[model samples]
Target chain A: MVQLGRRYGTGPSSLAEIALDEDLPRAYLEQLVTSLRDAGLVVSTRGAHGGYELGAPPSEIRMSDVLRALEGPIAPMICATDDPAHLLGCDRSARCTVNVLWVRVRDAISGTLDSMTLADLVPARNITLDPRDPTASPAGVA
Target chain B: MVQLGRRYGTGPSSLAEIALDEDLPRAYLEQLVTSLRDAGLVVSTRGAHGGYELGAPPSEIRMSDVLRALEGPIAPMICATDDPAHLLGCDRSARCTVNVLWVRVRDAISGTLDSMTLADLVPARNITLDPRDPTASPAGVA
Candidate 1:
């Protein structure tokens, strides 16, 4: 996603350019672009000046969507997934000990990813860093 | 990690039991157990009643360690890992576009997992599922 974003930031870039820039193999990137295109995340152009561009604005994309496109479901535990749910056959589903915690973590992760859009990740303005206080006490630091 | 945890949950559950319970394959579970035992997360005993058990108390173990033991590093971005840092070689180290965001996500995941021990997950108290209200919002319901 970052590689694509960076390449697109300088206007639409070819798969070859992106592959070289990201140090990923061009053959691998071709398949990746096809998947992204299939997901409607990227559009491809044919001919001499042809390349790839964001199918929609970067702001509209979510990291989770990108991840799911590249990888499958973002499940930490197989049991937490709904595409093929009830993966674990624990007899005591109503009171399974670790299931609840895994569910919480999976939900939290999904929620966090869903809450963030690509726009949140890439800003239009020049980025700056927040200054850190070297003299600040570590007392309250978590 | 849950699969591994189920395999080492202080029981005589066989590898087949763990795999069947977790909806994983016997061969895959076997490889995982070997890795876990090598990492000292589980110990194997011999005999008719022999099986795997937690090498350390659940409270003493962190999810980060378990995940690392099972998988590789928890780095979301290649550049944000200790194994091979600065993978992207971006000019702006302080203002890299995507690494910072991935680092935050990685930290959030690690922090949350580290805060939760297996003991916290497997409480003595039984879990109860609130009756589903059809009219209630999904966000507010589960």
Candidate 2:
């Protein structure tokens, strides 16, 4: 998604190019791109010069959205799912004590992913260093 | 583990009692208890009065430790696993861009779980509220 977002408006990039560049399987990319297209995260063009591009701007696409498109909602456990449909089926939902912990975990993950955008992950962007790491250096500094 | 921790130092709680109280299957509990016993998280006694108890205090056992003992290391993906045995087999470990994202997610989850001890999950310790909803009440509060 980030790659598609980066190359957005430039031209459609083929799955072949993306798979080779990303070192991922072309077949996996085909399946994943189908999901992305269905989720409206990526738009596909069919022609000799056509391929795939982000459905929207890089800044408009959040990691959470991309993750959800690929893997469904960010559920650590089925019982901890945010979707009401999933929650309806858990027999122990009313009395499960540990479900709270799983929910918190799911939220923490969702929170982190939602906080990041495709723009933030784009290559050549500013490096984010850990403030607690005294030995850490900036991206380009020697 | 929570049940064992809750029953810590009181007396050995039988697998049957724990399974019944937790609404889990007895056979599943047996297998899980075996893992817990092997992991040294719980100690078992022999004979008719035999049962299990936490090897340590509730506060001494973190959720991260319990999860690791039960589910193995918390890897969001095989490529993101902290276990060297798993990492050694990943051919794309060197150049996978998204491995960084998975590692961050694993770290976030580990940080949350590691920060919490079994004591934290014990009912009636503290009320956890949903930060997103100002109107949200604590778990039991009206």
DockQ of predictions, in order shown = 0.29, 0.43
Please give the lDDT score at residue A26 for candidate 2.
92
lDDT of 1 at A115: 72
Candidate closest to the true structure, highest lDDT: 2
- Per-residue lDDT for A1-142 in model 1, tens only? 6555645555567878877766678899888878888888888888887888887667788877876777767776776763465466556565466666566666667767777777776635433343564454423345
Residue A16, model 2: lDDT of 91
All candidates: TM-score: 0.57, 0.80
Segments in model 2 whose C-alpha atoms lie over 4 Å from true places: A23-25, A125-142, B125-142
Candidate 1, residue A33: lDDT: 79
For model 2 chain B, give the 10-residue run with minimal summed lDDT: B124-133
A1-142, model 2: which lDDT tens digit per residue? 7667657667799999888778789999999999889999999999898899998888788888899888887799998776666664478766567887898899889888887778766665334477776655433343
